[model samples]
Target: MAKKTKPIRPPADPLPPVIAPRVSAPPDPMSIDPEIQKMADDLSAKVHSPARDLELVDEFLDLYRRVFQQGNPIGLNEDITAVLTGRNARNGILFPPASPLIVKGQLVDRWGTPYWFHPNSSYQMEIRSAGPDKNLFTQDDVVKNPGPDNMGIGVGISQP
Candidate 1:
């Protein structure tokens, strides 16, 4: 009687090691270039008190326009506060990090709440204020959606 032999199985390929996605830390405010710091100070000094929602929205629109004129590409996923304050200033500095408008490294509203920024595209951004209530997404919340034309010489506002 012939002895039954077990079939030899080939070794299975080892699974690849999982690599975690790399997340970059936010830029340090103190490490900003001196030239950019000077530019931000100059621009920040020109900003007037934004008491109304329209003013706040207009401020953001004007910034976009200036960035466009500088020939810098707007980052759709970039933080507006960082971009404005020279931390992640891809479009150059437009606001000073030590300005009164910035509270705890955020761009605050008239009520001292951080403004929420939504970048719809390279040429479109939505600036939202918590309004007088200091709460967002309510009837009192003010949202201004500035489109592509506003980044040019033209100005327009879209509400959503």
Candidate 2:
């Protein structure tokens, strides 16, 4: 009779790799201004709301007014975003780079379209959101045409 060889057994299961939890850094204390902090809090409240488009614009106007005293960000949406998050910003970073509201360096609306900004004067600007349709200059667009002093006058959903 031939001698049977002992079969070798497989090694025990190895421990799974350890994955560290992701942790975001806290906002810088020195960079936090009182007014800007208040605005940040206010914006955070309405960031995900559907019926607060006008309010959101008002907050943005305040931020622009505070940062660029000469005028609002005078360019396309992304350019404006640069000023908002740049060195001259009072709050350091009103819109954090990793924020969902910011996409590709531009502040995007709920429909994922960069907001259209029309400067009327040194202290007034018309902010427009593409609205649910995601098309500019449409009836469904939400617009905030601030008065000569950035006052809310003809602020509502656009008509045709």
User: What would the TM-score be for candidate 1 when compared with the true structure?
Assistant: 0.48
Query: Judged by lDDT against the true structure, how good is candidate 1?
Result: 0.57
Which number leads on lDDT? Answer: 2
Highest TM-score model number: 2
How much RMSD separates candidate 2 from the native structure?
11.8
- Local distance difference test values of all predictions, in order: 0.57, 0.65
Quote model 2's TM-score.
0.60
Q: Model 1, 33-122: lDDT tens per residue?
A: 665555444434545433344454445456656765642234432355666655543545555556676777777766777776656565
Error of 2 at 27 (Å): 10
Record all residue pairs in model 2 with backbone atoms less than 3 Å apart, i.e. clashing.
Answer: none
Error of 1 at 145 (Å): 1.4
